[model samples]
Target: MTINHRAEAERHLSKASFMTGDGPNATPVNPAAADHYLRMAQVHATLATGQALVADASAYRAALASWRDIVAHFVAWGLSFAENDDEHGTYLRLAQRLDEAGLNIDNDIDKITPEFGKDPRGMWKPPTVRRAEWAAECAATNPPF
Candidate 1:
């Protein structure tokens, strides 16, 4: 990734970090997991932006893979911090962005959750569930969009 692209990704990830860690309505949950996932997302975003700037197909694929990993991390964190609606929705949007970018690791909307669904109230679950499901899906699927 170019320096500028990386910097841009850093900025976005920083935004995600703030959203995950500290907010007026932020959930008082696992700060460690929240920081981890948010930082992962930032890495993915940086990879994606860098690849886009260079127009490299291999880098693009790598970036997509990174995004998938970030989604998995988000799900795991969500489960551990079940009451953090802000973080839940934040990761949901990140997953959606990955999908829109055509990563399509596993097009399971359930994995993404109701932040984009019809539910007004957000929900949370255990990290293990999302971690196991993501591992199995990545192992079995061929990037199902």
Candidate 2:
């Protein structure tokens, strides 16, 4: 039997509620963790669709950027889950495919660093906190989609 990796990733992502709570009790889940899983689902879905469609270089590059963003989020949180998780093999496979396609994934990592800002204590704030602040700021300035 073949596994539908994209579907599996999406299932994992759905386990997190993001803005809303999950399950009967509606317990709030960690938004950062939710975002991490969502991004993981995105990475898998993008690769699945891109490969099926025979996507161009730009699409592959965008996927690489998204993957880098996930890594950056983990870095900001001071966590090594991205490097040590069970799905690490899947992540590396996708990365290798992009590399083989001539997409420089390292370039995306350089761009992701500036999005994280330092906290009052002079340490880099967690990605969850930064993402919430950014979302609030954007909502205040721009209309919701």
Candidate 3:
């Protein structure tokens, strides 16, 4: 059975919009909801990329914009969270990756480390493990979108 990754991407994007309170007088941005949508977007983007590798130009074209938007939203959300969370290195790593991909993240990297330095708690106890585990899990699974 062939998967329609484009449709899946749209579905995720819709969910993301709703999560961000795009509709009339809706609830404010829910962090958990935004994270959920961001993950869904990533899964669909990966699926679309896989399809494109097999010469599925339609899937690639359809998902490209959604993927870009998803990344943008994810970055924005993460940066907002990171602004206060002294122990969250995940956002900085995410920002670096996005920057490396030429996404032009406006958040300054220099600010992240200084924020951590100022905070008494500093970095997370087991730095990098949780983020690595999450990334691995995401890479391994293609959830039903």
Best by TM-score: 3
C-alpha RMSD of candidate 3: 27.6
How close is every model to the real structure, measured as TM-score? 0.27, 0.28, 0.33
Q: Compared to the true structure, candidate 3 yields what TM-score?
A: 0.33
| Each prediction's RMSD to truth | 26.9, 27.6, 27.6
- Clashes in model 1: which pairs? 79-125, 79-126, 79-127
Candidate that would win on lDDT: 3
Per-residue lDDT tens digits for candidate 2, residues 62-81, read 98778767765544333212
- Between candidates 2 and 3, which one is better according to TM-score? 3
lDDT of 3 by residue, 4-85 (tens): 8867887887888777565567768777888898788889888988877878677787798677666655544454444444
Q: Runs in model 1 with CA error above 4 Å?
A: 1-67, 105-145
- lDDT for residue 109 in candidate 1, whole number 0-100: 36
Better of 1 and 2 by TM-score: 2
Cα lDDT of candidate 1 equals 0.57
Of the candidates numbered 1 and 2, which has the greater lDDT value? 2
lDDT at position 44, candidate 3: 89
Which residue pairs in model 2 clash with each other?
A: none
